[model samples]
Target chain A: MSHASGPPPEDRIREDHRRAVEGAPDGGRDTTPAVGRRGGPALWRRAVEGSPVALARQAFKDARWSYLYKDDTSYRVRNGADANERIQAAARRMRGSTEIPEGVDANGPFINAPVWTWEVPAYFFLGGVATGSSFVALAADLAGDERSAAIARKVTIAAIGPGAPLLVLDLGRPARFLNMMRIFKPRSAMNAGAWCLMAFSTAGGAAVAADVLGRRRVAKVLGAQTALLGTYLGSYTGVLLASTAVPIWARSRLFLPPIFVCTAVATGAATNRLVLAATGMPSGHPTRDALGTIETVAMGAELALSSFNEKRLGQLADVLEHGRAGRLFEFARWAVRAGLMLRFTRGRFAWEHHVASGLYLAGGLAFRFAWIEAGKASAGDDEAVARMARGKATVKDRLRDGRTTARVRTSARHPGRDARAARVYADAVRRLSLAIEGVLRRG
Target chain B: MTEIAIDRPESRRMGFFTDTTVCIGCKACEVACKQWNDLPADGAVFRKTSSYDHTGSLSASTWRHVRFVEQTEPVPLPDLPAYGGGNGGHGEVDLVAAAEAHGVPQMDRWLFMSDVCKHCTNAGCLDACPTGALIRTEFETVIVQPDVCNGCGYCVPSCPFGVINRDPYDGRAAKCTLCYDRLEDGLEPACAKSCPTDSILFGPYDELVETAKGRVLALHERGVTDAYLYGAGDEPGEQLAGELGAFFLLTAPPERFGLPAQAESPAQENGPVATAAGLAAAALGLAAAVGAFARAHRR
Candidate 1:
């Protein structure tokens, strides 16, 4: 019926006119001809109106819209429920394939997980052991007490056993840990440290072993030698972190090493006190009191140094303020406070003081853990790295601009445009090439 | 034996002018140092993914470190590409265009600076060290004595720039000696010698200062208003005021390059606080111990 006699030409024209006007730009001219000129609405249809590609493209667009807006997935399975529920679920499903969950092996490959060097923790442990042993020795020497010396020897031996293992374990190849002693390279702190530990450990172990074997006279002689070597062993851990190129570590070098030394002493004192208490040694013993005093001093120094360094680091202070480092620092602070409280109240609360000493020991270990963690945190972040890169680029850009300006200034004095231009261009090209090459190579 | 005058100021002081402006972040200085010193390649294997720096921070093996920094700016110039392309690459020529085309609000810029031991005038590391491990050489450069270091690592935190580090393997503090061996032979440091752009300039302390001043003036004249010399003036202390052994002509704030703008002495900062705390703790402990002894005697 429509083919023979559709609506009146005027009626069809009005309907078509409304559709065209709806699609036109509000402020633009209407360029479509009257529907009457084409005879009817059917006359306005194009030859490619039913093209499959066009329909597919529209279908793709609809599917993309659903996929982007809705989280519906393509996979479907029976839920042992109603069919109506299934249909509803299917309707909700987005047209595109679902993204595989992360960590699912069947999904796809992912970036290799990052493995941080364990050397940081090893450094922390060794430094702690060495410093702690030194404090014991220092207290013993100051008090003219032989028992303290005995305790110091014991602490030093313990330090060597655990500290040495940690240091070796930190090596990429544990077997190669011994290779550090192959040569005496002065430029390498680790090489120097390996030798120091070897000598100190050997001497300390001899003193400790002799004492254990009931050779009091020999032990005394060996103890003195151990003390001499132990001081160096304890102190060097501080310098080890300082000698590096990491800005955060290097900038805080002066304080970091000292802090480590002080921390070690505190840890050693706490450990000895805990041992004395567990062994039922008399409370308020002069040696125990002296050890506590040494621990208190060392803890104070370590806390103060860490706090000062963090404050001075400014934006970089995030390493100590947040994440795992922040947690470590928090625990360390708690331990230090508990230790100080116990030491202060030692006369009033003897058993409580021992408990506090235990806390102090925990705190010291935590401090080392936190310090190492923070240092690693500092190295892992992108903000610091990006900041450093930008600083270098700024300097480089200025230098390049300066050189170019200098060349232009020099070339301006020349008479010939060709020669001056050639010189300037060549110089610019050379400089640019070098700059680019440098960036690429660095990357 | 003839004795040197203690009060008379030393005339010849060696120094380093790490231009930072021209540093390519190659870390050649670090590698060259280990090679020249015959140091072990310990931390070299730890490739840091956060930045181009793989060795993380300075350690026993790495004496000279080149730090890489990235910064962002609001204005985008079409001429500068994010990653610098090669000499003949189209990216090189169209860097400016690409930057402009992106029309992004923030654009990143890179910085590279090779850092080394400051070898300061006061040398806090030397002052704080108990074993006399850290010492000022005849060349006026601070060096850690490996034999004497005792692994105390006091010098590590004593340094304001954190340049000194102790080796984990040997337990000794180590750092750049300004290639003291090379200096002894009247040769420049391996870093300065190998630097293609002369970014790591090695010279007499006074001459470098003067040259740095002249360069700063030249930069200002060329409209590089941000250029300034750090650790060159006498603001922080009289000792550091005259010149820095390892100074820098920085384009931005020194902190951007991880160098504090004002010199911070770690020993000075912590000294009084630590001392006060130590004294207080000692007094409290002694008082408690004495009271405990008296009570025990009474019992």
Candidate 2:
């Protein structure tokens, strides 16, 4: 609207100077336009103004000034408007426009969230159970419980049935599943896990076959070999998860494998115990007592290791405490607790042992799902990923920042007890994060 | 005697040295990379918060990404005068007058960086790929062999820089190859060739490192004291197995650009983790078996 008329003010001013330099009789004053540099005649000269159209326009614009400019935050432009002021106003608007909200990662969601779905966790559960069953079969044979050993061997084969297929089904290209066996890269946990799974399945299957054929010596030899590979099969998934950049899984490296192995044994023993009970094995049977003891110890260890790892994860543990994963973890904890309680206070009923076994199996499966889901959540957490990548520096920086903020808030609230209160608060924080402190100091 | 055969000289290790100080944020490198690689479009979703960086981060389809970080905090521009227009109205932006009136409007700096794969010497993806799909080229650039990749998705999580990704449509992992095909034909990478500011310099690894060091020194001489080389490091954690094939000269902290401060191959931690896992499994598995059998004997 300002540029809706003739030549710009600068051009007009230059033209006026050119005319004055030509030695015109009346200089450039008479030829000057009524609409000048400021865009209108002075208010005092309004009555003598030559252009009535320009004067009328000015009066109308002034009358509607408040209405037009009321909502505009840059209303100070009414005093003076220039390119610099306009640019500054734009910069101001841009600055206020879309600030990355507090706690939102400015640079990233970081690593690609794990692409695994239900199939992977399901496979983990089945694989763990199979490995655990193999161990049970070997142990039972050594204990001279041939009946229970045969049942354990059958269980191992049963679990391995769907485990291999579930793992293949989770691949992006399922048809290319055989590619995993094309290389023997022990450096890769996944490759090592694949080989272990194959070895365990082959040996376990042969053992089950031999047992059915009444070849006890051949079955025992194969069962021992299967159990040897089962150690990796049950625990290498932990290594697989830990060897990645996912914060929670990688941070819980030392605990995840042991936790996984414990769950495998617990679930395996539970399955074998339930089968034996269903076959009318008496409650006083030595095999039943052994299975019960093994299951109980394994469950206890799983719970203890999980708690320790969760404490070490710090704020990264939030993924395991909120959302779907959190609910699954909660259920798993309760299921294990219920199973342990039933084991401790079992009645004469065989159904009580069956129920306890069922709880342990369900709990182990739920634990696998919870860990997988927690890993996905942890991978998507930009702060946790950044903390992992930045390593101990970010942890220390955040801890220091947290302490300062706490001190400031406390000082503002209680000036007299600032030092003492701050010290107490800092000490509590230090204790809470002490699990990671050793690693940080070592690094 | 058998006829003596002529031998070819050993291939020189090549790399990219990205000097982000002079980058103009033109995004020519992004276009050139996609155009040359024949990669698919990364969908059309206008990201309102990520500034002009619409092609977000480096992914399977988009190999080179120009990161735009709009730092709006008020920073001191020491070289420029706060007040302006004293001498014949030449000064356009009267920052002092504007600041005095508007209480210092936030317009500090607009940092632009062209990010690509770090192509680490000890790449986590290469180490973790179970299918033997990811391999290091003669130029020392890590590339995923698309034909061989089974899309097991192991490499996706193993990359510490988050540069490699499994394409949802293709169902295979993909990332920058450092223009291996172009290198074979004695041509520079498309991204480096198309860079308007010569920000992305492609050359022999040793020569590029020297050039990068010289540029960093020049920047420091010109008062850009904060300028430092990332990935071209002597420190252990700063480099992944000695150095990255594609390193950067950055003014801001590495995290500000989504690069890790302590860059390392996640696979490097495999030894201790595997050892502990194996020990734990052995101890727990053996103990449970032994305890179960011993208890049966006692009974």
Candidate 3:
């Protein structure tokens, strides 16, 4: 064998023959010996001999083959079948029922897990805050509240400082993030959002710089421009999510954007309220009260809209009420509730207002995290995806009055065992809404 | 059986017509695809639950995957030893023979489907791509330019079928190109060529659809009434935006093969609705802010 320690006797003899040929007068012309001098067979002959078919043929020729191992597996041999006879038999058996086979898990085949992690939600939160702050700045400037406007402009700049970096960090190729600007695609929400973010950041920076430089006219114009772009920035993250095949996000198409915007406005106003209060703004100052009122309304709307959409999501809504997303959402709900409570019960103490603002901001940020986490979970849910594909998950389906399709049959492998949990969930939402109503009435 | 001719002046829209019924759970196509594409193996994962499907689903490295859905009824544990004794040396129960001999009910079955990228008419990944990395070839198949993809991962969630994915090693999104290189040389895709039963057919798009329809009809005539074409039609105002370049003739529902029956490109409907809603909310917030500030100023 070629794998042996030394050349075989035949190769050794051929080498001696080649040396003899070289020593002889006419042997130099004889190339045959030179061809045989190699340790193994010729390349072509070796290739042919080494081929699997050749080896198998040789094996069969040597009487090594039997019915037990006649190029078929032991399973096939035992079944006494040939050419997919077993599979054909199975296929024939399956024709009796349309129901999917028991214990056959379909979820294993779906690979639509969300790639976006914490950085994406973090970026979304930051962008929303920046946009919100910019809007506040614009509103304050327009209302002739220069001091509030100045503070909001500073907040806008600070909030947007890490927006692009965080977004780039989230990319699979961080260095290639600039490629996002290579094309102008308005149809793609991510593309539009990227451009809006860049533009908003630029306008915000310029507005802040102009304000510092005493360029009042330039600052106002730029502030207005910043706010305009901020509007897109505040809600485009939701659009980005909605424009994906992720079931929960796509189904909440009409609501996600508005919900995001409400949070942005709430968080922005909350930040302003906290900043003003921290600067020793007297209790019930006109600007502080306005900011608080704006924060309260926006936070309230965000809570209501999210609850409505969560209900609309049907069975798919389990993503939001369970898992990591569920925990985060639970925290956000309490934070918003506490914030609203504090806002309603305004005391003489400035710390009370600061706590309320802090709670609103925390709630808004947590909502973003919860939504993103839920989206990740939603993408992996095969039944939810199937439901989405069947036009049963979206409001568009209801508008078309789609035929009431049967719910996906649950199995031991799949998730859908939450009837009692769902009841508790509904009760909680009902009680929460009632509490919100009572708070509003008392206020 | 349309022969793939080598000498053609121009490329016609060609695609795969995967008939799942005739598939025999053999993973020859998957092997051929991996060998031809020089794709990295998804390192040893012994999946005890998913019968013979260790690779799981189609992903960046795995362009073609054979999905094994075992529908066989649970055989009694006591019958197992008896079948082994009857079968002699190998000591394995002959499940098919047992079912055929009425030892087990004939309702037991196994379904095999080889899944690949759908290559939708209005591909969500292509539309949602911000870098213009994804493009439609002359054959009407969507391809991602590796050099252009910045790995923004927008296309990852954009795919309705979850075929495209970013490679963990490089972070660049990768998927089946329908063997673009092979097609350019007038060769059939590796997966189609390797399919032993002609389960994965390759030909002109229109011809393939007709052939698939005929195959379904033929199956129906053969008493396989469940056989139907998925991603074959352009239903007006339906969720499926348009026809799939690579479609399937399935015996079970699309979801059984991890395919969405009524997938839509989010760009067409969802994108617009979201943007409109966002704009409206922004306007509302802006107005609210202005009004609130005005009231504060008066105070």
Candidate 4:
């Protein structure tokens, strides 16, 4: 395959081949090529004289060539001088006879390209808004404080306003957004998401409107709906990521949904606290106390779950614990710590400690962005795939070994009358042993 | 008089099986998704430099995403003794030495997977939406009700795949609906129908899972042993009751596919923790306030 590369150091090639074939069954008996001169198999005649390294290399090359030109079938018949020549010949055959093809270049035609476009940052932003708003709503509802509840409702509505538009704009055809409700397919995540968003928004808006209109009864009904809708809205993002084919995201799928919910709750709590402080809510107000508690607990769960996810998925840990994601994680940690400290602190600092709440909000949003970015990065890499392949191989090898050993033991116990039975059993054992050896040696 | 009943037929469910083994990494599914749904063409300005996958990740506009990965390893091609050479391949190709001589990069493998929204059995987005905008279809696919959405981004955070997003321009939550209109019309989804490689096979949920298991077994039988299914066969929690509507056959660990092998519901798991922490903080703050008030009164 080398282009005038001066026949690549013959000694190195020979040495490699020798090393590869060192423990062949034939054991250096017949010093000849595995294939006969007439391009035919010579398995029985040769005792593995050819270099194993060369053999392995040839096998891989043959596999690639065969796979590439399998459809043509006839390409193998017309042998070329080298692998590249064969590939070129196969490509030529596949393209069909052409004379000065117009608009065709050496690089081949751009047959199919991706038409879909995903705005990564937009996903992060929308998630943050949704979760942040949910936290505020939850804290407000729990505390039974009208002022806090109104602010929470407003925040939730505002967050959704920006979030919904971004989602629709992301679609190549924004006009068809309404088609999502034409029919409900329970299996489709988008369908469910549409309903969730509608319910949450309506309840939230109704609640807010009722509060503005001074209708306590209407507000109470809407508030209940808002809480229900908010719960699903805060948690579904996890299911969405888990449902995809990206390894990193899929592996930690279960963990993400709950984490997102917690993060949202934490963020919402921070926002609620900030709003309350700004509005000069009394220091010992139940609403303030509830928001502080939610913030501290939510932050703790978020950090703990994230840590658990990282520990459970080893090499995959690189996504969150290393790179830019690690920085985000650190920031989130600091925010949580500060929020907790502020929430627990007493006296003068308690009344003036909205700084920690602000930090939590910022940190929560940053964490959401970090996760989205990390998932994107994780999906873009190949090392994770290779590692999975290796893991599968190990499992398969173990199963095969166990099966072989069981068969050998069963045969031994049977004690068949004929010597052939014994010989067959012995051969099976030998093959199994060799296979085990191979695996060990390779490892 | 009316009869009360439970376990409706509509609740039984349907799903998708995405076989990544044969995926050619062609984003035909992604294109078909946008076209069939009449979604706006997600603008073409973005570029994901890491791989050929320019779509980046799933979003409202791009409901389907194709991921590309490249892996490298030192592997020697088999020598062709059948040709007219000596011990090495015909004419002594010396692939390794030749590779070194030509300064070729080390051997590498490429893997490509097309990602889409996972309509979980227990969808967090569906659980978290306070506006009732997101709902489960009769077919069990999760969808967003655009008209009622009111742009509450709650569903965005609730999704695990990060698949759903609000269109920056239109203010509505959006993501894949598995072509619900087509399904109603007795047709396969556009993405599954358009997949040339049969990589994204569409069928009854049960059959797909069976087929996936068979394929994984076949791959194991062959030398390509690193094959497994994700989001199938296990119901972890009440929040996640059934298997996924969309599942995948991956060559790597679940994480590599951006999925959690052991799925958990973030909302359910963290809700209590967050609530507890909030209560604790509130108690402490209240105690401090009461103590300060007493001190002032005593003075």
Candidate 3: where is the Cα deviation over 4 Å? A1-108, A394-443, B1-9, B74-107, B237-239
Clashes of each: 72, 0, 0, 151
- DockQ class, candidate 4: incorrect
lDDT of 4 by residue, A1-443 (tens): 00112322223444556778889877644323333321111133235654242223321231122221133321122222453332223222222122212332121000111112244234544554554555455434444455666777777777676666666555433443454454443333445656777787777888889889998667766766676566666666655555443445545654776677677666766776777677888776766766666666677778888888777777766767677767887787787777667766664666446777777777777777677667656654444423322222122221112222211000002213455664455345434534543465478
Expressed as tens digits, the lDDT of each residue in A1-443 for candidate 3 is 00124543334555666877786867654323333222111123434543353222321132222232232422112222231232233233332223334543444445476787788888888888888888888888888988888889989999999989988877766656666776566877888888888898889999899989999889889999999998899988998998888888888888999999999999989888787777777776778878888999999999999998888777879999999999999999999999889877846676787888899989998999999889889988887776666556654444133222311111112123444574355345434533543465478
Deviating ranges (above 4 Å) for candidate 4: A1-144, A345-347, A388-443, B1-299
Q: Output the number of the DockQ-best candidate.
A: 3
Q: For residues B141-223, what per-residue lDDT tens digits would candidate 1 score against the true structure?
A: 77765534444444554555556655544445677788876664456677776676667777777666655555554444444
Q: Which candidate do you rate higher for TM-score, 2 or 4?
A: 2
Ranking by TM-score: 3, 2, 1, 4
**What does candidate 2's lDDT look like per residue over A202-233, in tens digits?**
99999989998999999999999988888888
Q: Better model by lDDT, 2 or 3?
A: 3
Quote the TM-score that chain A achieves in each candidate: 0.58, 0.65, 0.67, 0.59
Comparing 1 with 3 on TM-score, the higher-scoring candidate is 3
Angstrom error of the Cα, residue A398, model 3: value is: 3.6
Error of 1 at A347 (Å): 17
Ranking by DockQ: 3, 2, 4, 1
lDDT, candidate 3, B70-155, per-residue tens = 76665332222222224444666666556558755536567888889887777888878887667777677788876567678888
Candidate 3 has which clashing residue pairs, if any? none
